[model samples]
Target: MTTSSRLADTPLAGELIRGALEIESTGRGLLPHRLPAWARAQCADGQLHMAESQPSGVRLVFRTRATVVELDTIPTKRVYAGAPPRPDGVYELLVDGRPAGRGSVPGGDTLHLDAATGTAARRPGPAGTLRFGGLPDRMKDVEVWLPHDETTELVALRADAHVEPAPEPDRPVWLHHGSSISHGSNATVPTGIWPARAARLGGVELVNLGFGGGALLDPFTARTIRDTAADLISVKIGVNLVNADLMRSRAFGPAVHGFLDTIRDGHPTTPLLVVSPLYCPIHEDTPGPAAFDLEALAAGEVRFTATGKPDERASGKLTLNVIREELARLVARRAADDPNLHHLDGRRLYGEDDFAELPLPDGLHLDAAAHRRVGERFAALALTGAGPLAARGRRRV
Candidate 1:
């Protein structure tokens, strides 16, 4: 529906955004960025850039009485060469903190990605509108959650009534960083991602720094975590390091220590949890540098496989098992004096038994059901009794 005379453009400012560290006022409208400008400027990798641009847990929150709402956005969607077309990213509507509606824009810019070669050809498209009507005709808190897997540029927000920034949530912020699984992967929607789900279940505000193929233990990322204020902090390590074959055993331990040290600089005594990688059959005992399962891709399916030889572990190559062992040992060694530091075995979230029932379709990322399982497990393990944040007192889920 076209905006009536009473409808006015609601300035999409940083105050309207949650789960993002910065907002960039763009030529089109506004863009929410998970990583700050300085951290982004330090990395030139296309993967990191794209991952951060996809607002995994980001949402636009406001209080309004409008019965009709419209949002215009230009989403940069990725399409793999020769593979089946991916679905349009979804925008989830929450009214008074509950699911109310869901919609997707029809057209937007496209990134034609080559899965095998890791290259993308960009094609610009016109902006599309997502309109929600029949909203409750009274002042209510509304949230429009951006697509978890698409890079979106907010163009406009219009309503028949004035919109104001919603009151900030009175919950402790939970900052989490990890790989594609934490970035949503195949979780289906923005709030369905594991971290988002866990945040809801645990009653905490979420600041997710999970990046697809961009979780390398970079100094800049550590600094970002150090500066961001959070009541609970977690770093899910191992998966990306192994898949990218980024570092060997000798370097991994020191890198992890340094990452934790940087965060402690800002959050001295906050409850910090170091979670190891979730179980992945492909990377359990096999060292990586994982590669695409070309045969599956040829059949129009996406799958990943480990390429490093098992024997390489003897020479310092990292595998899921080795990384888990190292992380557990390091956390145990450090907890001697750092009482607030804790470790959770990643298998506790997704173990071999869970895998049997819900095998990872792509041999890497979790599907929607698996995402729910992991999220629920995380809430039980880290947000409740005997967990790292136990002292904060659990909220009703």
Candidate 2:
């Protein structure tokens, strides 16, 4: 069949393959579905909702095609106070509404899955790809499930298909990096990650370089961004650097400058946004080595407390305020020569308002509601030309 004819025939062609299912927790109340696509045509309304009232926790199911495909789950690496302790269990992957694979995420580890084996397994970071080699060529749906777990938070779900290729020329590619929050922490699905959600919302393709706990101004990552092919780009930094105490003020400024320099070496004129950290109370003004509260973890609980006092400078921590100030200064200096460069305070996406309403359970990563808020703000800022940054080729540099 002609490509155009095939496109006419497959109504769901180029549509996202996976979506979220509402899972309930007695302790957490009704959990929201993650990454609901902005394209109404691509979404199935009320598809995933609270189904039962079991005390053990809520049992939720996703709706999707039946073709058997590989499934993988990414886990949270950084644990802090009030953070949900990683849960261990036999998580399930259901394809076309049937159990196609089963896997186990050992307690205190991230889980990965594939069709060859259904159960969840520990993965290195909040990123993994699932390959589904032998499936009906004209598949229609897909779904994934996480069994009851007190600690596990579904980050993302990705599926590979053998359908006709996407029209690459029609879409711009977005390259992004950030902390665990950007790496899909607390997000329910792979595409639910804020970057992914924003990309889908903006009708762009995405090359997600978000590495959980790996956004520390690494030269290699900067180089990777410099070399990658992207029509548009952005980097979400600061929070991770501050939270991890990876660098102090002296090194932070240089590192930020260098990272931007590397990216500019390739796409000198691409609209590049430098996003600072989102809202986190404990780290808002304190410095870090944001250590996990072992006491809470050992007790199978999550908590976040002030690690450094306001008057204490001996600890040499970088707070959100510090990062934000530095980032603004850096961008101001760079924008003088690089008009394409822009800076955005992460709170513009998830700010004190959100923190007040849907406070992060761990005081670090955003919860599902906060994720939606961030996604919406990002779409408005990055896509709609609503923020200070302009869209497409409007940059002078």
Candidate 3:
């Protein structure tokens, strides 16, 4: 018999296996309802290392034949010094209110959890799906327990579900790169990351290359993008570079061009949008190292300040205005010969008008509502052309 036929005859033989569960926080609490726990564990020593400002919560979940389930509880808001010292203790995973499994978070490992094993490590892999094998056909609830001293934020619960995969299309893929904001920071769910959301909204397949604190115009990253598959693509730049203060204008322009040149080597005519930074008050017109408020840190508040003098424009510091102007000029020069190249102000996606109504609590990342708004705008701008390969053509207004 054919492999497909043979597998069909055996119910579990070829059945789809479950992967890591992904869950995102709705507010300051867990997502509504109990979810199935396929697997769970604790990252004892590394449970405290997180973004400069984040709440403490556990990242736990289950993997099933078709879907991944996650359970997360909000913790008290506080600023952690660093990863806590190693603790030898049992982290519990409960499925349907009963103990399913337990594991220990090893010392010297990163605080981030591995979706597959549910242990925290000193360094985590790039964000992606985690897979698991064997699960009960149906389940409704799950819970995870960490030591009282440990804390975490339930950012995402990701898992593969049994739903039929969307039919594969002949469309060209879109490869994109950005920063933590693009990496889905502060998002409520894995699929809710702005790029993922926008990809879905635009009806295109996407390979998200966003990495937290990793989009510093690194040559390796540029090469990776240049080498990746894509019919058309864009890069959301500026914000992270500015926040990190990685490079000044002298190098920024060439880096941008070089990044494009590398990509063009493979995709000569692909429509590429070079996006500038979005609205950020502190970096609006200044350079870095962006100063952080120690008082805020002591108070468990996270904030950034411009480190440059208000009147000086020659300082090494960079502002959103500077990035935007450079990007527009760069694209204008490139578009003259490269018709497929384009530019978009990130503000067009999330502008001052939106901020006036709903300001970011941290002055950096967008909230769930703001993420949705940006996604919708991105969809309208990039998708909807003759076919997936054809450039939909954005007008320079």
Candidate 4:
């Protein structure tokens, strides 16, 4: 047998990864996980399992002078059973914090899911390479951002020169958790995702906990956040709860309190901001358990619509409006004693005006342009002068 012509023997270490909490060695390569193994072990839900492995905000960061780079990866691309095929996941390259190039590995694996039946099938494929050439020859920091929505298994990293972990930045760390919107639904590129964009504009290091369809207020998730080290923390709540129809008003308040309590156990005084959900007309007053728009799916487009009735509110069924009011009250009451705590109405980031101009194409997640607008708004509102997330003693100069 002839020897294969690939150089991937060196094992990947945690130091090269930025946003992931854990790295697992697989037969193929190293897989980054946003949640710890303990937390992942506690979950049996396939959605959560898949979301945590997607590496939404994770990137391989290093210092190198290589003019050419190659990454061997196995990306598990997703597809709705009847909907049009999704595009391959994109890997973005950044040189010294500036956009340099973008590429995608041709093939790896396919995950076919039936939304109506809530079933999924996985098919394995071969690993592919992502190559970037003609990079600057001078030594500089290099970052390879993994696809935000795809499950990517990194087999090996190859460069023309020596590679080492990039020095940790002195910026404050911003840890954020939310739903698919924050996880980067519909945002074409990884860096275009609102959180990534916001992290850049805000001049902060990001550890994103956003998980698609898996952001329910779970104790294990809260515990994960509690154990993590963050200088500034924010949890965007509401949309996922409403869409899943996971809890009624009665349970939501206590659950929110419990979630915050768990985090406070670890960080008693770190600046904590609780943000509500952005505006979605379908769920504004209507409760959910949102359903796919079958007609749209049949027409080769994926869309979502609320199924719960508006009248359910009388029975403590939660809606976006109900969630906002409750969150506002909870923050106000708690902020009195906890001076560092604050609340942001999510609509402030993307509201009616934004909706009119840039509608959510899938009726739930923001498109690429909307994500950029939201990130800019967030940077201006929370990361600038005297804002809720303003770095202590550092103001916009």
Candidate 5:
């Protein structure tokens, strides 16, 4: 395999970027997790544990000019043993604020999940390497965005030239939490996720807490957001709750209140916006445990279908419709005293009309083009003039 020669052969453990929490040192290299040790200790669910290790916004930032770059990593890639094969997660490389390269590693450890049984098996595998050559001969700022979906443990960073940490940009930090949509389930690349895209367009830094299948109104998640330092904060709710069938209308409302209450405990006056879920057609009027559309899979694509009956709503089961209504009411009630708190209908970002134009390819999560549209709309709708984010900037800074 090609490797950097001019740069020292030894791995640079001391020279890592600052986006991750604590980097766990391993015999092989470094594992970057979004969750700190304390927060991780509170959850027993395997899904949440796995999601925390995905490193949604983590990256390696530095300056180098070796004309060749190599990043070695061992990613815990998820695989459905019987389901269709998934594409390898991608890493994004940016040089001097310009797109430099994009590619995926060849192989890594795999978690083979059984679609029918809801069980998984860990299969050990070898580390894979990604290399980029022909970089400009002069030193420039470089950022290597980690994969959004896979659990990546960075093994080594090598470039033929010297590297140093890039200077911190004077930009607002946005801490956001949501479900799989925000976790970038269908996004094409790491930075291609809507939150990442929105952060770039809004000229802000991002701390994404978009846990896939794991944004289930967990108190620990709220506490994590409370502890993180950020200038702007948002929480996107609904789809995950409804789709997982994890809670009912009665519980979801109070759960949300408690979640926001914890965040407010830490960020008393931070401009906090509560966003509802995106336009997911299956769960809009119907309740869920959304099931895989086997028919679609048989037809050679993946999609989701709602399984809960509409009558289940009478028992307080949540649907996207119920969630939006409750969220609006809850926010309005709280906003009477909490002027810093605001609400945005998730549909506003991706509405019915938009769905008519560009349906969610999987019947649930937004596809690549949809991600771009939602991200651009979010920047315009939530970060522009008179928006809550803008208003906060005026008040705080």
Candidate 6:
């Protein structure tokens, strides 16, 4: 299964991949972005640009007979001030569409984030190499799943034998958009994220648009989803809006309607599920903009606390309780008219009782175990029954 070409000669670039909308070659690697160049041009803020470029659900697929496969890349790792270092991003190898092996490449530039100042600084680091060896001699389909949370740049890829793009899988494509919780905020690895887990369980290809701290129910995001090909779609709403204190109740209903309206423009019959926020103790009854607990940070702990007063709800400020109520009401009304539309209480996936058993560690995001639990619960709730995503059919909508 050996090839005659040298490592330098066989370096596969982004053109061999199918998922990325934009791929830009850098001095060290090739950066792949989820949003297209046209959509990216519409964005002016650096934060939004960075969030959309984090290659969530983007995978490099190929077929190879090589025993050894290698990848060279630079991953943009996050470094939060005063908090413990998070795990390195994972690159999962799927042989014939099933997980075969996983590896993490070390050495990458770090994005230093300061909670107090709400600013980020980049520090340069060396590129890391990922190698997967000891594969079967026969040719097989392979897919390299990029980090769900990190911004990855593909510098090069090499195989002992020839490698070509893997054949497409005839499976439903599930497009999902959400906030940081869906973005693998505290999850240990990329594949460990709930949506990734749910995608596998549901046996569907994934197109994740979960942006960390960036899901503000943006019109651009809705338009992007509308343009993307999806048989199933779900939008996890409310957490970012509530935690960021971005909108009041009055704006929430109309905004949700507009977002769904935009997505329906393209996917009129695609089953769409609307999910509310999970159980976050800090934002359940209290309103946000959630602030970091500086005292806990000084003690080398990352904790979130609501800054807005509980009485703010009467003034239209959002809380988890308020958001859940509004979202349920909105979805119910929409479902009454549109059969493809459905609603799921995020609490049903991770409710109060579950919280008492496996509570959210940082008062915001769920831990790895919680992620697994939520993912399994969601698979059962959304992928079964006479629900919207159960079977494809034209209904009276």
**Highest lDDT model number:** 1
Give one digit per residue, the lDDT tens place, for model 3 in 218-260. Answer: 6656665666567667888887777667788888899998988
Q: In angstroms, how far off is 278's CA in candidate 6?
A: 1.3
What's the candidate order when arranged by decreasing lDDT?
A: 1, 4, 5, 6, 2, 3
Name the runs in model 2 displaced over 4 angstroms.
1-169, 313-316, 387-397
4 against 6, candidate with superior TM-score = 4
**Candidate lDDT values, in order:** 0.91, 0.56, 0.54, 0.90, 0.84, 0.82
Clashes of 4: 0
What would you estimate as the lDDT of candidate 2? Answer: 0.56
lDDT of 2 at 112: 41
**Model 6 Cα displacement at 273 (Å)?**
0.9
In candidate 3, stretches whose alpha carbon ends up further than 4 angstroms from where it belongs are: 1-79, 82-171, 385-397
In model 4, the runs with Cα more than 4 Å from the true position are: 1-11, 393-397
lDDT of 1 by residue, 350-395 (tens): 9999999999999999999999999999999998767786537423
Residue 260: error of model 3 in Å?
Answer: 0.7
Q: Candidate 5 clash total?
A: 0
lDDT of 2 by residue, 1-397 (tens): 0111112122221123222222323231223222212322232322111111100111223333324343333323323233453433344454443545555443234434332233334444333323333444454434333332223433333333343322223556666666667756676544445765686577665555555566778676677677767767889987777656667677888888898999999888888999988888888877765755657656775555656666544445578888888899989998999887888888889888888899987767777677777877898887666643334543222
How high a TM-score does candidate 6 get? 0.92
| TM values, all candidates | 0.97, 0.63, 0.62, 0.96, 0.95, 0.92
Candidate 2 similarity to native, TM-score: 0.63
Rank the candidate models, highest TM-score first: 1, 4, 5, 6, 2, 3
Error of 5 at 103 (Å): 1.3
lDDT of 6 by residue, 238-351 (tens): 989988899998899999999999999998988999999888888999999988888887888888889999998899999998989988988899888898799998999998
Estimate the overall C-alpha local distance difference test score of candidate 4: 0.90
